[model samples]
Target: MNIAYPYAVSLEEDGVYFVQFRDLEEAFTQGASLEEAAFNAAEVLTGILAYRLDHNQEIPAPSAAQPGERLATPGVEVQSALLLRQARAGRSLSDLANAMQTSWPAVQRLENPHHWPTLKQLDKAARALGKRLVLSLE
Candidate 1:
């Protein structure tokens, strides 16, 4: 599914930052660096989407990735990469869970747009599904 929600990012203080999405409230964080702020914003967006899904609530479309934007947070990038790799490798969620000795729900959470798994967890999932986690250097 395509997501299209618009968000604005702003600095609130020395280390604090805020990300505001349309029709959604605001999310804040105190990152040690600018990159860290963008990264947290991605996770914040992921968690918000997951909450909306878990509660069967309405979700807003994904917003465009602004320049200097983390684009897709590392966590989200990991999640998306795993799913695409598994799909291309002919591996299903069931296959992954069985191999990893975990519940399919765990796999489900990793793939679901709503469930933004931690980057560490995403790496494990990618490995479990016979996929390798990679980050492209720009």
Candidate 2:
């Protein structure tokens, strides 16, 4: 199963930026900038998920975008997964938008944890990030 969670990447009064997941409210990772925050967030998510799997805890029930608001799409978790993968590869939002020849805001909307992407767009994003997406019915 897949799960999508909130990620608030905000710039504080200082020059530093941080990313904290809604699912892991108690935990937060910070960086000097958005790129670094995105990178560290990926690491944090990997560790968090690994801990859950090791402890046999149920994955957080896809709580980011609500159940039906996204329509028939690849689901929030998968889109988040793609977002993380691209972030891991050091691909910034502008980089991806440039590659896809779209506006930066379009890609930003696709990556924002609370928003949803259409199924076709999800596929395009995954492919852009060097990932393969599959949908399974539970």
The candidate that wins on lDDT is 2
lDDT of 2 by residue, 8-118 (tens): 777788988867676666547888977787667766665665455345454454455443222112334444644444443667878777766789888766755445577
Evaluated at residue 132, the lDDT of candidate 1 is: 72
Candidate 2, run of 10 with poorest lDDT: 66-75
User: What TM-score against the true fold does each predicted structure earn?
Assistant: 0.44, 0.43
Q: What's the lDDT of the predicted structure labeled candidate 2?
A: 0.60
Off by over 4 Å in 2: 1-4, 65-138
Query: What TM-score, to 2 decimals, does candidate 2 have?
Result: 0.43
> What are the lDDT figures for the candidates, one per model?
0.57, 0.60
- lDDT score, residue 13, model 1? 63
| Poorly placed runs, candidate 1 (over 4 Å) | 63-138
Give, for candidate 1, the lowest lDDT window spanning 10 residues: 70-79
* Model 1: per-residue Cα lDDT over 1-138, one tens digit each: 233345556777665666555445754443566677666666776666556545646544446666644343324543463344334355676887787678988766665654556667766776775667675543
User: Which residue pairs collide in model 1, if any?
Assistant: 3-62, 4-61, 4-62, 5-61, 5-62, 5-63, 50-114
